[model samples]
Target: MPYKLSATLSAHSADVRALSSPTNDLILSASRDSTAISWQRATDQPGFVPSNVLRPSSRYVNSITYIPPSADAPKGFVVTGSQDTIVNVFALDKAKDEPDFSLIGHTENVCALNATPNGTIVSGSWDKTAKVWKDFKLAHDLKGHQQSVWAVLAVDEDKVLTGSADKTIKLWQQHKAVHTYNGHQDAVRGLALITDIGFASCSNDSEIRVWTFGGDLVYTLSGHTSFVYSLSVLPNGDIVSGGEDRSVRIWRDGECTQTIVHPAISVWAVSTMPNGDVVSGCSDGIVRVFSTSEDRWASEADLKEYEDKVAGQALQAQQVGDIKKSDLPGPEALQIPGKKPGDVKMVKNGSIVEAHQWDSASGSWQKIGEVVDAVGQDRKQLYQGKEYDYVFDVDIQDGVPALKLPYNITENPYSAAQTFLQNNDLPLTYVDEVVRFIEKNTAGVNIGTGGNEYVDPFTGASRYQASTASTGTAPASAYMDPFTGASRYISGSGSTPSQAPSSAHMDPFTGASRYSGAASVPAPTTNILPVTQCNTFKQANVAAMQSKLHQFNEGLQNEISTSSLAMYPQEVTAIDEIFAYLGQTIATPPQQPSVTLTAAHVEAIIQVLSRWPTSQRFPVIDLSRILTGLCPRVLDAPGLKDRFFEALFKASDWSDPWSPPPPKPRETNILLLLRTLVNSFQERAGLEDGAWPTRVFESLSQAPYAVLTKTQRVALATVLFKFVFSTKPRAPRPF
Candidate 1:
């Protein structure tokens, strides 16, 4: 089936991120403009009309899904996800302004949303988890993904599929991992249900793969040249996909049968309507509906215009000179004297100018003629008194002034302005203004008063002078102020009313007064000093220090390399000893355990971590496990958590000269600390007196935001939300 344009809904000022249909005739679109708009197909109307605009979030609304009528909502509603990390459910019949209820569990941007048939909502987020909600309450957290969850699809009551930046698809059964499917080499961006046993998935790698419920790959559909972001199943079982390539491809039987090219660069969303129409949301902020059973949904005039545009592109492409056979690579070896392929044929590159006209009879664009400008065949024209290699026609409206410009490229801007004013019939009153305007707008216009002694270029007469520099015997009336356009009284000349000789001057630098009769030595040298470039020298002490440090590092590396055998065994022995001590402590419980941890304990832990195998994540894992096991035993220990954190910070190996090169403190490490604290605090029912969260907030407020990674920032927010702002469920108070 071929789809034709049906309607163009263009209200969003930002990219439309998602689209959904609550009912057969109603479409909902979510955009970065922080709004979810509902469009309705009016009865007996040619196009859909915007019926409602719901804005529940203050940030970009990234996802929207339709919800069928449930017991809680008598009428069906729409759910929207935004960058605020919250999902809001808006009632269908509520005032076109806000959401009826909100669900907030994700700690990062809520990027994708899907509603199951059982009134269960699934939301995917950058927090690397998917949340299931029922009746606006958190149902379950699906948390196996190692990266941001980009797409979510509820295939059936028993199964949910999630795509993630980790380039894997996870099938979930009751919020538990059923099977992990891995095939794409990049982030999995979109998913569509083909059947209960099969589904389709697209990714940033530009390939759409079909998979079975049993984790079997069916077929890989490849057509798009860029990231495939959206996918939908047609009524006939054919798959429709849109992507960054600006084209929508229809896949059936493992091949693309049809391709619809959009004018936008990235087709962000696609949904199949109940009537078999395809609704596409684009980065250009337009929501367009295309129909397969086209009865010419667009008017005749619009269709003609679109067809003409396509034809014009084809004509322009044809007019561009193509690479010919002669332009191909020459023979492998040098040509023999008097060879058959004499001198190697060469083709001159030329640009073709194709003239197109609207053929009213056929309602299309038609090429009438063509001109080829061959290389070296210079075309010239003479305008006014100057010759120009190119002449361009400038159209003028009935009342708007024409843009008068010089045809020759090498013309003075001042003269051009004069000519333009003359041609436009401008009064002479605007001559000075025009000159100033031209000087302000153009470059290389050297028309201005030379100095304080202003001499008119046209009359060659002095019109102004500086009152302070009036050494000449000119009268006071001769001097005029340029800025105020007024005459001024002459002031004393160089602190003496009587004028001195023109050549007489003082050697101010030497503190020597001017001689009465003889000229000062060298006539008081006119040249004071010449600007010379400073020869900046490198700091010898700093350079020596850096060189010594580099040599020391090299020496350390050499020593370590030569002693690998001894070092390897020593490192293993040290790690084994630390592990054995910790393992024994975990196995046996000590009565009246000490709450205070000392620097010695921290040093042992740091040594084990530094000497451990670099390829394995066991050190961090063991650290998390140790913290998890120790937290429960210290719940009653007051001020012990603060001491524990202080000891951990002091555990850095950078202070140890022999500590094998320490890595810089990274934001990821900070996130690890935050995640551990948040989980631990929740287990302990939050920190008592809530002082820790406050301290954390103050520290974050003082720290530069630019230094924090996005994940680190989000983790900090999650910490605040989970501990500081969180409270036990309370009943609604009567108003």
Candidate 2:
């Protein structure tokens, strides 16, 4: 009750994409229009209102997160990821317009970002890569998602869990993706982690999924008809998700058991407060607070004009001639026509429209004024030479006030095509022209698999190119081609196919090339069309079912029903309630596990060690985020996983040191055992010519992890555990 809209902050010129409250009193908001603003709630409102204003950014801020201060004193920091493919960091109290750090190198838009205990930031980009940054410099790039990355959460202090537009979530050990959850059909937008167990996520695919670090599906919660736009896991083990269907649902144990009226209105973000109230920020430029006490789901409106119809129906000797039940307090319930009985959607948005009367006597289709006792929409006649195309909806029905149409008609073929393709994995019916356009406008590309001749889309001249081959790897002369795929080239020549070489002869270094001089770029070919509509529909159903099964796999042992927790209508299962409480409680605690400064964590320390103790000003590189998780995999033998955390807990009092330490020898043995494991991994992944894993690990070990603070150490530990030990495998899609 004491909170009176502490700060009325105007976030952005457009939709606010993300917000992070790093400081208890401050909120940083990022917007779709490529901007970010810092806001503060006044500690004393009697004098000045707490208002947040914009910061400096030329592009829309896609994501913002606060990193906990590393030093003993409080440090005010805000990190933002922008569409410009840069991660910008600001120190709130420092000089105006001064960025403490500006990390770049991502080739596409940065979609998600998170801060770590070490003065480092991790970000996911549309380039299908995740990166770690420290002090305005580049870091190691993590190649994972087949599509754009959408959201990310630090697994501990070091590792990160990234959800992507590719309908998968990857667990990254620092900069290396160690595991992936490829179950959801829709792009993931939000994720919440629970200790070292794994995490939960919401996706545009209309479902919630939970996964362990090992990439195992734990459990799946369902029930949203539209895209799940926002989600928050409550401390009490319940999940609150806001969907495009215009309803906010609460889930406990993975099922939608309750719903709340929320006409969606473009929900951009959702957060669960400690007091159980859920706040949703929408595209309408307004924030709404929904609580349990007023959880009354509105009953369908009983149009008063239908009173006579209801009265007559109640009659017919029903309980002695319509007993006084007719004198109810609510509107007289009416059986609305043109809708199925007992349909919830009927009352939500349904109406009848009367057609213009054809007055034969006047030889004209004239407006007959209006029809009485009918709900209707207004429409207008549009003359199109011969017959009339509808200009707009106009109601001729007499029952009510002014008429209005629910929607307008307009050409949206591209949107329609996108929806169709997404739903059925089909290609556009006709795309030859589109291919030619890309060739003209884009970096002219010529796709080929074998070394041969290809006709240009425009010139119609034969250009030596590789033919589409069975293996994705193209000859030195071809673009990397995957196995047995139909592909399209943005060649200058109109609808012509490239030729394959009669004999296998290709220069290794020269690889593949085309006439206009473009390397064999990734193909734009997909078998979207040609499939039978009925079969495609059936396949779509199978895909959806598979997604559900995959969700079940990721959900593991936990699930939350999609219902309103404030006024839950469904019966609560005995055990689920405990987790619901824990989910909510997680909000209050700092979300990082304990850390132990081990050999692997310190491996990356060499980079900073060369600069030494007081070298706060050192060469900034991508090593920061990469080392936190990657170093452990190479330098430490025992990978970071659930077991690693348990073992680390016994050796450190960094988290909660209420109990006495473990016996001396037991602690020493575990540490030495972990050390030996690290040594073995170092040997396996060292820079020597070996497996790709070894090369990656060796490259990561060249850096040191010692400069990381205790918190950073712990974060690094968690990152390594999630990355090195997670066992989830991502499902790859054929393009």
Candidate 3:
């Protein structure tokens, strides 16, 4: 018998992203609404009801697991990982708004969580690291992944497994990576342990791979047409999976046995109960339970309503692959029998196109939905095995092949531009141009609202403004900070630093607009000075940045025209040495770097920034920012500071006419340049001659105050403040 809908639990107001079924009677679910719910099976009915609601974070709670009960928590603990980069534990017996323990370590969103029977918990994060915790304390920091760690499994008290966006699965023993299994062609999203034959992993490549612990490939399961988000194992050894394809599939021995379609855009998570029932969390904010037992199934009326809901969905043509209305058969196609249980057949019914699936248990074709051609129907296109909302052909130069600019509607435009520029070895200066291209093509489409809103706290700059239907332009006044929910600092009359909203202050150093609880410095009065010291943006993920720089170098190396732009052997060594220096300095209990930085490293950064395209120059510019702050002496030589500032201005297109609301990439570059300038105001910054500093201010004065973004204005102000403080003794007093 195939799985049938047993119960529908609906309370969350947003997408349910993760689920954990510890037993037949207990189910834990985390949702985008920032709440984790504990559902208990009713004694009088077959349905499950929300027994307790735990508010673990203000942001989305993305992953959940169960911990066995102990003396402190009699009813056990429901552990949740959230977008806030915090893992919280809530005891069932003391369910409340606050968590019992908040485990904080990962620097990015905690997206995956798993627990061992002995009460140890493992968490994977977008920070590219996994962490193990025991007894409510940090136990081990599993760090080796080159990208975000998206999937984690606690094999036992000592052994752990992690799957990463880098497309490799790692077996870890304590804090060290013992082995890495590579096969997935795309981001690995989900992992589930099999009874004996190692484990099964699913990826954005739309294929599920089974692998052994001994580093052997078992088999691959291919059926899902989109990114698989989750996987779970049933008691009977069958594997259940869910994905962006809106289906929950049951697989047995490498073959899909049944496909349970959902009435949602994505089935985000799937978990199995002790009795073999499958629980799924969906984008529709519903947690559903499916069971093969007919007695446990929903009533006939409820089942029919559910079926009608699925059948009434208007699916786009791309959702079912490239469908041609002319090639589809009429209603007679349903008359023939289907060979497999989950086989799909599309038939044209008069003016309507219906999608039907073969249901083996009922021995008939069930109408799933109606396919319709909607606006932006061509939106989900595949590029490099991953589905993106748009993949544009961008011509960088004449007579050269156009580069691919792949973007998702939900992604930050600046990020997309940087990625495109980085991947193509284009200059960072083109970031603004690319951003304009994206905005021009994607205009009039409402984005960054409802379920699709950008909710990640770390990347708040990417959040879009909610636009009005009357005008395509997103209102500047209505731009809200994604984290604080306060209006962003908009420069103009009636908006002064003191009068601005309390949470609207932007961090000039990082270009981050979120409130940091720093006491506001009073506005300068009569040049007496504000008497406050300025801070530099010094914190960074050195490893990730180094990886990206090398990746871009590899891209340049593989290309003909850009080969000259690739880093020379000594330049590469210099960059590596600088990164190594930064890694040690940024590490906890900072250690001295083995090799001290010299003029060669400074020259290396200058060389890259001067030659690389504008889009590809950010990392090098960022490196300059770090270098200026930490090793100002490197630029102390004659003409060195002048060359550095010249390179920075050219890389950021400082001479270009200032536009209100600069493109994200350009804005970022400008901000970094300003921060670097601020850092240059320190002692021994080689500013005694004042020639280069004059040039810096002269280039900056080109952009009118009205045209500068709030963050840029703040950074420029900081540069002036730092300059005055650094050279106040040398300043000639008024006669």
Q: Which number leads on lDDT?
A: 3
Q: What lDDT tens digits, residue by residue, belong to model 3 across residues 1-735?
A: 789999999998777888999888999999888889999999987799999998888888889999988888888999999879999988899658878899989887899999997799999998777899998899998866667888999988999999988899989888766778899998898999998899999998889999999989999998888779899999989999998777999999888899999988678899999999999988778899999999999999999999999998777666787789889999998999989867889999998999999887788899989986533322245454344655666543323334577866556667888787766434676665565455444444444426333222222211222222212222333332221223333322222122223343333346675443332222223434554656556646677679768857764654445667889999999999999988887779989878887777788888888778776677788877877877777787778788888889889988887776677667778878987888778553866786767777788788888776666677788888888778767744231
Report the Cα RMSD per candidate: 26.4, 25.4, 12.7
Per-model TM-score, in order, reads: 0.49, 0.42, 0.64
Q: lDDT of candidate 3?
A: 0.77
After superposition, candidate 2 runs with Cα above 4 Å error = 1-11, 22-24, 43-52, 70-75, 135-137, 195-197, 255-264, 273-277, 288-345, 348-735
**Clashes in model 1: which pairs?**
none
lDDT at 111, model 3: 90
Best by TM-score: 3
lDDT of 2 by residue, 13-131 (tens): 45556666543345566665555665554565411222534454666566778776644325567787775777777766544565666776887667778766666677877666677
Q: Rank candidates, lDDT, best first.
A: 3, 1, 2
lDDT of 1 by residue, 85-160 (tens): 8899988776666578889788777888999877788999877788888767987778766567889998776578
Model 3 stretches with alpha carbons more than 4 Å out: 374-442, 447-735
lDDT of each: 0.57, 0.43, 0.77
For candidate 1, give the lDDT of residue 732.
35
Clashes (backbone N, CA, C under 3 Å), per candidate, total 0, 109, 10
